[model samples]
Target: MTESSIEANYNRAKLEADKVDLLIAEALENGCSFLVEAGAGSGKTYSLNQAAAWVQENKWAEYRKNAQSAVCITYTNAAVEVIKERLPENSPVLPRTIHAFAWEAIKQYQSFLVKTVTENLDYMPDEGDFARVDEVRYTLGNRYRENGVQYLYHDDVLKLFCELLDNGKFRRMFADRYPLILIDEYQDSYGPIVEKFVEYFIEPGAAPQFGFFGDAWQTIYQSNKACGAISSDWLKVIRKGSNFRSAPRIVRLLNDIRPDLPQTSAIDGFEGEVVVITNDDYSGSRRNDRNFKGELPPDVLRERLDEVTGLIRGNVLPEETTKTLMITHKVLASQQGYDELLAIIGDALRDEEDVFLIFFKDVVEPVYRALCESDHAGLFEALGVKRYPINKKSDKIRWHELRRSLESARNSKAIDVVNAVVGSGLVPIPPKIEGWMSLYRGDSSTLYASSASIGQYLGLDYQQFVAAIEFLQPDASFSTEHGVKGEEYDNVVFAIGRGWNLYQFDVYAPMITGQVPIPSGKQASFERNRNLFYVCCSRPRKRLFFFVSIPLSLEFRSFLHDLAGEENCYTYGDFLREWPERTIAACVKNGAS
Candidate 1:
């Protein structure tokens, strides 16, 4: 290797090898349990992998056999994929989401494996046997109804799962597995499910090893729909407080906010000025439309987005390194409509090589389209009739071919196919069919519940859905606040529009709710927003920008500025004040570059 290459490798090797043995030793020590407080970019995953290796090595050494395997649980599908990808080849670490792990464990036990879920209500007799689902929905909805609240489906599922585990089902499954349980983003797992895991799986004599990684600053979501935190009660806490992901200058900014941070080698000796633009001149006249109470008007936000795009085109380094993350405090409540903003941004960033965005509304379409392309056949088999499998397969193949034809046709956007498949008159729904097939939500009551139904009814069984999916015009990537957890970007710009104000779990609500004095939760929520902001900003590892569109309500605006560093904050109007003379020129230059 050349001198520089050898030196670079030596430096990385030294960091990796340093104290790695100590971490492993602690994890494997008998009667050992640890709750590690790892900040973003702190190699938390590395530590977890190291611990898993220690567990496996000890199992083989002590018992003369491989252990069941270490269980590493994270909150998001992306994290699951990341863990799986990052793990060393041939490593036996079993990283999965809590839900996936739960389902897997339940699958091993016959009674826990549910064949079907029947939702039957007395007044809604047409519904099937969702006895428990009905009760909890009624109970939670009734309580929230009087208070003007909406209860989600999985919230109750979390409570029910917890109840089952607390009652010993969870414990019984893990009784002999010798599985080491590792939790990531622990703050997001605080509901009954987590309590049950701790009480039954960790606290009891299960003797499984435990490794927890998460920042106390970024605990935004939990099953309880409340603020999440790293409680004082967790056993044997070890804080991985230093940030290896951020430059020293950025670390200083975070540390100024959080004084108790640990020291680490994530980022050191890097210097950069932190710029906070408080845009005060832009009046948010657009989002005030009375029709949508909790959304930033897409047009208004789009205007602000245009300005930020202008700045990025002019100033950001390494062009493609710049990524803008438009995060609202709440995705569901945004009035501006996520899809509309996404369509607009996709247009703005369409040509920019380095500039990318994470918007909530439009990110899933591509994934759905991709899945239909790759797994359309498997999906058909899983959901379609067994006796008529060949018939189904033939239809799917034809659909795939047709979609390919549509793309090959050129000039026409795929909306023609979408309309043909979903719109009126293609395949008339039987008058006997009570519910319209939902192309979006996969519920059985809906006549065509999944992509499978669309293919099945359209006689695509002869071809495949891949053809139909091929016609879908690709949109930009935008994730919900919840969606971007455990994910990071270098330059993050939050469009904390009206949605954050409308959503029930806005993280700012706890600050509004006097019932719980969880400033930490509120702070954590703000910090989670900030953490997400930091995550998106730190993602580039070079620059960060926050574009928080002013909301119609001053209250909402104040909440955003508070979370986004009031001193460094700016409004859309603020950009108009400076009117960077080169703004338009910058866009042209950046676009050209």
Candidate 2:
């Protein structure tokens, strides 16, 4: 807190900021490609935006003279929005998702693509092919017309663009158009086509300067084995090791967990507590407990809930000043388990808004949007209000009425609302909504009936969906590990060993303890488990409580003890015996003070 100490801290922060600027300047100046391995909580996005700004400020004259713009490619549309918001208006930096960027390229070079495709194909397109293309165009809401070839799906556009990029003329044209190509979350970019695109465009001594920003250790996408293959002798590799999100204790724990990806804490000597609680008395055998047997036994589940409840009550203030999160690896593995956790948290935090529900209601959201598209009279009829519209001319008033009705029915069952709307004949049901309902009601024996298939059926990754909806308010204090990434809390209770198909806790637990070597074939799985654990454990800014359902081997217990300290590592039985009294004493002391 001294003046000199404050100045030193300020200087340290400034240097960290400058490091990114220096990397960007070096890559831009030399026209050499680079990859920045920005770890979790590293300001990757901010650095990307700064790089964009640098290009605009320093190279704008050269770019403008050639009618070119600096292009930033993000992993998600949400990321694109963030980058767009951060950049100044008319900054000449084109920020877009990969798909959006591809679509734009298709639009810009439609004529060239048509010519190439026609020349490459053995047979000319017939009316049926054009009919299918028309369907695609309608589906994508693309209305542009060029040489009567006005139809293309997203994949088709990407394929055509890739083909065009292979042509030397088009490749040079693209490089001229985009002199600086920056890809965010590059590790998640996979697929043979994507690999070809990256290789073709980002070749050594290419006209455009390409920079990739990502963490290979955090490449949790199982299908992306090519992520690590992106590195080359010519590519400049920069490592951003300072973690600005977590406390020093959490950073140290992350380093211990994944020594391959060692990170340093930005804040010096920052303190936090890490508690590892295991259910050593669980009845399941190691062989049978790989997936935690899908659900915990009744008593064990109660004990786990009790530990979570006690932690929240003891460490979490009633005033809700400090944020708290309870993360589980499985959010929808067992509906019964999910409901029980919600019930327990609701009862414990009665009338408190701290326990927010995070879920992907994508299956329901589009239906709701469709229902809301109806006019006021139709919506009222659907809701059984039997009210006539007072102002027929104003669509805005009708929209407000529809919004209020939909808002009030937010918690209603999707089936009931859909039935009401369809039965009332308010509006024609969209085909997409009907298709979704069909999948939801599909045969239990079908692939879509399985819990693992729901996400794919709904056109989303389940973990990503859970992460996207963390802000929605609901009557629960539960979230998936993926959902809590990059988010901090004062208190965190993470439930591991849940039956998530992707995470093999049996394999991971042993790997963590050094009991077994991570199989070369399953290295991706190992890295994913490590990354998820790191993300969950590092979320707590002050206190972390980990509850593992399966019985832990002695080696695993020792591993937990080493990371959390023996004083903080406790068996479920030990915690139950000691924590209640400690909780009571703390509450009494706080009251007395």
Candidate 3:
């Protein structure tokens, strides 16, 4: 390994290694509220753990008692789990999701009835407790209907929670409970909610120490205004530049596109190609139709997939190739063109030694199971899947019974519903008494569907839903303009759809960097679209194959032509001057012509 590689790894370790110890050291040296800006993959949770440890240690030494409490406000339940997992073995940090933290703080000073009233007003109680809140929501819906107000989205739940906190009683509850606070993914948090914290939790002279971590680039998700207060001038800002997940070559390529990114040491020794694919060479407008002209067709996508998959299969390295991933936009993934490509890859890899065909679409079912928390057999019945290894009629009966049990629980006590869903982990249910109970009262919905789906379909329960989802996740390896984010994958194949040409600054240039100013609504859409495209192009680490359906864009074509005068890194045939007649032939043969 190079010296830079060693340094990169060391830097990563410094942020993640016994981070709590360093946090304590800093806290002991300065009692002033400390603000930390954590970047992507910068070990934000580890730092929080260290800060909590410091609080507990100093409280015992100086005050002969435990610190009042440390509150960690995170964006998601998954973030809560990550913090819990990273805390010191016996750490006392009260890590929780923002809503959970808020609820716990508010619940302490309020009566159960008051808390119940708050929950009813806001439809965010747990599944078992949904009825109480649902009743309130229904009533509110009727009242709102009379007033021309609409039903609620999930965020309205937090809005109601904030309303309750606006009352002095609940505000004091949070202030008195946790003395120090750390928030993760605070960027995605609701703005009003954070403002509430500043108003209520910020101690006048000695505010609680605060640490936060997130990236504005990836903050393309909703709620941009939420973390506005935590921006550079108001808060201490530190950028974690290194990407622990992607290889250096991949990072470099991505940086080339997004030059404003922070320079981090995380990408030191990694090397790989980041190819850009496009279709531009079509000389004749054989088909002048608006949809068909100079665009990627199904056959072209299929051919690219086969070619890309074949290239990777040729360059085998035991477990190394598993990291390559193919990522496309949500639209592309759902397209018939993508389906054809999958079939091509599948056929090409059927006899290949170590290659695996992982379709990103497969993740949907597992995620659905996670949401529903029910058996796949019941779902199959619900989805109208009749054929199974076991008797079809028997499975349908079991499905009906499971639905009946769910309705019963919904009508009965809320706890009864929770208990039933949390009871059965993953076992398939019969229509019998025990099966109905097992299927309903269970904590592991993901497990139940995964096991049931594989059992009935493949004759063996495969507890691999999580693995499968991860395996097919978006990764940073492909050359397609759309790169994956928030997930990683191995072994990527790039299938630049016919839409690649649309990325030319000259094509969509009017929306950005052009004389014609974009409309505000269209401007927002373009920004989001650009951010998403950039995210998708950075998901691979290994070999990259360019499967261009047409050719190159106007700017790209000019650039390539200019480059041809200086170097030969690419091929002339890679440029498309004419749409392949074969595509039309194939499309007609498949009856899509």
Each model's lDDT comes to: 0.46, 0.59, 0.44
Looking at candidate 1, the ten consecutive residues that score lowest on lDDT are 353-362
Error of 2 at 436 (Å): 12
Estimate TM-scores for all models: 0.58, 0.69, 0.56
Q: Model 3, 404-495: lDDT tens per residue? A: 55455544432343344434232232344245345444432323232232112222112222222233444322222332445444444444
| lDDT (Cα) of model 3 | 0.44
Q: How accurate is candidate 1 locally (lDDT)?
A: 0.46
Order the numbered candidates by TM-score, best leading: 2, 1, 3
Candidate 1, residue 473: the lDDT equals 21
Q: Lowest lDDT 10-mer window, candidate 3?
A: 352-361
Give candidate 3 misplaced runs (Cα > 4 Å): 1-67, 88-90, 109-157, 198-206, 223-229, 257-261, 267-269, 281-294, 321-484, 490-523, 542-593
Candidate 2 local lDDT, 167-215, one digit each (tens):
7887777777888888888877645544665577555556677888877
TM-score of 2: 0.69
What's every prediction's RMSD, in angstroms?
11.8, 9.2, 14.2
